[model samples]
Target: MERWQRGDGRLIVATNAFGLGIDAPDVRVESGRGGRDGERSEAIVVMPAGRQEELQKKIARAKARTQPWKIQSRVMRPWETKQVEWEKMERFLSGSRCRRIYLDSEMDDRQDRKRCEVGEERCDVCEKDDAMVEDGEARRAAYVEEQRVIQEQAAQAERERQGPWVDSGIDVPSSSRNIPVPSSEVLVPGSVIVTSPQPFTDQDITSSEEEGRPIPQSQCSSVSFDQGFAADHDPVGESRMFEAQKQQRSQQRWRVEADSQREGHEVWNLETRLDSW
Candidate 1:
């Protein structure tokens, strides 16, 4: 493992299900499945490495057994058929041409038909003769710089998209209008400008209740998003709404009901808040 860290030992021999979402940046030896998330990685198969033949025989017998080593049919992602993807895998490991070209041919997944280019991610076979690691490094540096510039441009666009800062339009009284607008049309950062909704005054509340009309843009009773947080004025918060003659009609009704009542009359209140004898 430490040899792998020193950029020497990158030959991983085991084949397992460990490449679904692996994010490691170092080289890996997968089962012909290079980095799925497009991170730079590699895969290798050692033909008759110094290991003994007895180890191979044990693994082969394990594969042929009826125990848990048996290969189960896995569900295909694109379809319901059980597709064994080992044929392409075998071709990629044994082929002598560019590793990328083999993958592109087998997968047929390239946007445009092009071979492995210099300075991009390349395999051991392509870089064996040239040995130009500097090209790949420079390409990565350019990619990082381009992404940073694009990110800054996107941020500027978002700020421009926000446009101008409009006032809440809920009237602020003359006393608290002390904070003047900033010099720049856009709001300056770190400037704490506090505002509140317009409140109903004592005279306004009294007049609204007596006139039997809704308080003009009450800032608490009801919320009106259209006028920027307009609230219905509710004095005393009793939620009382008197009809044009609801009070007069109630008084007259009780008077009629008590036309010839006794000295002590049992009073009952109706749903309309009218008293009856």
Candidate 2:
């Protein structure tokens, strides 16, 4: 076993004595009647029908050998325990119940009713039978899907409860007056300062007011600053600017639809535009 652990042997085939005190993490496959790490390990026990009779005969022989009064008490206790273990093994091998359930019942003293009651995948009996296993798999899949949907719904509810400005404490800006104009120079790495064509000046605002026509909010909204980490330096200003741009676009869309309706033209729809294209 030590040689196998040290990579001297790739495999080892021995009795139950070889497994005791062995702590090899990379031991993938082990075959024997006993000893396990209670992990994803496989234990295959091959017990012939005649083995029970043979074991009983051996126990009888041992008992007869130790029948002398002096050693009877010392030997009898261990032999009795072995007899009980043998009977349990025989019952497990012969039982028609799930192999895993049977093993759990014997090893951990767990009740059969509680073992794998909620869509366990497979066992000796389940693998041999197809219809029952398929039903169990379908139920497990549905249960997993249901749990995922519930989690997603809970996350959506939390986001809705928190609202749009959950991360930043600043409220969403509503108009062009609150929007911050981006500077010409990049203030942070990977930050692009997008400037609009025909920049809005005080003169332009005055001219629009004199003409009795409000300057479309979209003009101010088009100038957005990608400040990146610089936003952390001034979170309030950054959030206000982002919110103002968003509101400007929304208001501009509404105004466009209203203007189209006044002119007796159908509102610009994606399907109509695509059809024309």
Candidate 3:
């Protein structure tokens, strides 16, 4: 005969479903399961004023013959399972301080293993779920750091690979009368200079004259231009600049997909926009 919030209530010393249609403003319901020898209590039935005593006795008897309550257990959601496996994979792949932090969050019973350091408990994802939380978090952090290092190394290598196209302080067209020496160099950074190669027109003419050969009247029919972007020739820094810009666009696209779950956009698409070099 009262009103209360959804889960708050007072103790009821009754026998039949203590809070059946209960709307008490303040109540704390407790079962006498331990105190009594499984005996019925005074609050076992609703004392309806007009009900016959015989009917009430019959209802109580029927209730006593029925089974008791059933309890339900909690289960993990699908996303939770996916996230855990992903973090596990991260821990396996990581190799940095970040990985250590993630691992400290995942495995709890590994205190004896000394898998994680002691003082890393204060990080962002480190505080939850105690020991396992710290382990998993450490693993993720390490994985992230390793992946970052690998990416940086790879990028450095790529730049090195593109080195030959940059200037290397080598003499090009400076020694006009000398026979040009052939270099054994593969492309590396700082090989090619931003300035265009010196024109070979006079050299070509001089060589042709010396060889008693006449210049052809027309350009060759089978020649074609390669429109590829060489990392060195780009005074505008298109390759590096555009690549960074593309990365930003890709991150933005990913964020949008996360929010809306829509398709038709991708990071690789922005990266592969080298049609015009």
Candidate 4:
């Protein structure tokens, strides 16, 4: 046992009578550790003839509070109370349906239990059940994965339809119609575009010019304010808004830039440019 624990021994050839039956924590860890590299592997527990009967006899004797011939080691405990852990182990070893179902039923009082399904790695009983299954396991796995992805997409769409705050799991009010999009999109040179954030687009400059109404990157304001609106705050007495090229939004100090040119970056930001006579 020490050699096995220390990686010295490669194989363990013995009955798993104590661990698999009564000791829940000790069972399956070593066997399951084989497929750690994400490859297909199996952990099989072999039961010899008359082994279960022997285990049953021992369990019965223990349940009856009969004294053993010799004192048990520290690992095996004396009957502290009527604990049903031993019985659970017995049922687990002898379960017919899904192994996970049995385990979950024990762990949580779960009535709506699920099996291994088509895509998952089957337990021993499940493998035996589908010994002559017509459908390929690989196909089943793919179908299961696809279903999961579809579910995630659906969840995201639901959140988006509700609101941005819904996706953030906050109770603050926000517009579902005007969800945020990227602002730092590149445009062609000589495209004197307006970045009024209502709706974002990538329309050709020439096409827009020919259309008579040059469509801007009209992504109207999408905000996630703790205690504020989309537009800036304005005071009643002081009117600093629209003083120059810059405009001070209502109820806010931050200045909205009409246009600013950086090195190798041309930005044309305005609401709409209608030639008024």
Best by lDDT: 2
Tell me the deviation in Å of residue 82 in model 2.
1.5
lDDT of 1 by residue, 1-277 (tens): 4565576875544436545555556544353456666665544456665342444454456458885644455645644332335434444554344677766665657645344686566566676634656677889999999999999999889657533322132334333244333342344468865444556789988998999997675433333434354345454332232332355457657877776463224332242356333
Candidate 2 on 1-277: residue-level lDDT in tens? Answer: 5577678988567786766766657653334223354445555567876775675565556657954646556556877899878766654555344566656665567674533344554555556666777889999999999999999999999777656654554554343334566455445566856555456788889999999996754333433333321111456788776787577567768999888786665544655888999
Residue-pair clash count for candidate 3: 50
Candidates in order, TM-scores: namely: 0.23, 0.31, 0.19, 0.27
- Candidate 3 per-residue C-alpha lDDT over 67-175 given as tens digits, one digit per residue, 9 for 90 to 100: 7755443676888779768645434342222433334445433333333347432322234335687799999999999999999999899668645333332223322
Q: Which whole-number lDDT from 0 to 100 does residue 136 have in model 3?
A: 90
For each candidate, what is the lDDT? Answer: 0.54, 0.61, 0.47, 0.54
Ranking according to TM-score, highest score first: 2, 4, 1, 3
Ranking by lDDT, best first? 2, 4, 1, 3
Candidate with better TM-score, 3 vs 4: 4
User: Between prediction 2 and prediction 3, which has the larger lDDT?
Assistant: 2
Which stretches in model 2 have alpha-carbon errors above 4 Å?
28-40, 47-77, 112-115, 129-277
Off by over 4 Å in 3: 1-128, 166-264, 267-277
Q: Which candidate gets the maximum TM-score versus the true structure?
A: 2
Q: Which ten residues in a row have the lowest lDDT in candidate 4?
A: 244-253
